[model samples]
Target: MNTPAHLLMGAAVFGRPAQTKILLAAFFGAVLPDLSLYVMAGTSLLILGISPQRVFNELYFSDAWQTVFAIDNSFILWGILCLVAIWWRRPWAVALTGAALLHLCLDFPLHHDDGRPHFWPMSNWVFESPVSYWDSAQGANWVAPIELVMALACGVVLLVRRVPIWAVPLTLVLMAAEIWIVRQWLFFFTNS
Candidate 1:
């Protein structure tokens, strides 16, 4: 699933606390796994003085980098973080970690052969589901439109529930941006 879908689903599932901090934590948690891309790109730009195009070209296309980032974003690490949060009695941390786990759960079934190593560090295992959320060649052409509809519905739910004024619109915009980027830039660059 896309980040916005994960965020909205997390919020819908765990929004009962109705606390701003908790909601924000959930939002961040949904996106935390994907931060490896930003971290790598930022480091490449700042530390190595690499151009953005080269960074994207290398990192997004390299199998080794993909494996490394997959391990970095694995479920085992997030699960351990959640366990630690519970042990430390940090409610917000627990909420954040729980939402991250939820994101992984959603992703587990949506990825194709190039799936995350969800059990990395413990084991280099990937589920490699037949369906992919973004790859049209991997039976995801139908999923994109359905996911957009679901995201819109989630946005309406958030608006009706009186979530922060910016939440729904921001979610929608982010969702649209992700769809656009995947369809226009990422697919074109990677596939061609």
Candidate 2:
């Protein structure tokens, strides 16, 4: 899935009670982690390559540094962060965490296909995705197709669930477009 998918999923998850403000917040939070992938940061894709994803993973979620954290799985860190965020009463905590979690879950399916490290330390377990290696331009197998389908499904569910009618079209469009954009970036530029 792309950033838009993350945003949309986050919106769908956090938009409960259906507030436009929450939906908007989750959308931004979903893509916030990608700042690490920008080249001017001196730590973007040009410098770190695909490991850019890893850096983002660790920047906010991975508990790789703590003796007691043992964050082999990102969810634990997210859960902990949620607690922290809630304690601080951060309005964006749930939305941000939802976006981040969606990003990780989407990556899980893709990681299996690309042989990327999903288990980190637990052992190489493919979630059985046929993605078979990550690329920026040409996503492995039918990633674009799959992403499109899922994005559409999410849109329909969101709409049927009575998400504001006006919001539906833009979210739907953004989700589809973002998938294509990320697919291109991950496969095409990464190779360059």
Q: Which parts of model 2 have CA positions greater than 4 angstroms off?
A: 39-76, 85-92, 112-139, 161-166, 176-192
Off by over 4 Å in 1: 42-71, 86-89, 166-169, 178-192
Candidate 2 worst ten-residue window by lDDT: 64-73
lDDT of 2 by residue, 1-192 (tens): 565666666676766556676666666656654433333224444565536555445533333222212232345565566678778876667777666666666766664323233343454343656453344334544565566566666666677777766777877787667666756755564645
TM-score of 2: 0.56
Q: What is the C-alpha lDDT of each candidate?
A: 0.73, 0.57
Error of 2 at 172 (Å): 3.7
For residue 170, model 1's alpha carbon misses the true position, in angstroms, by 2.6
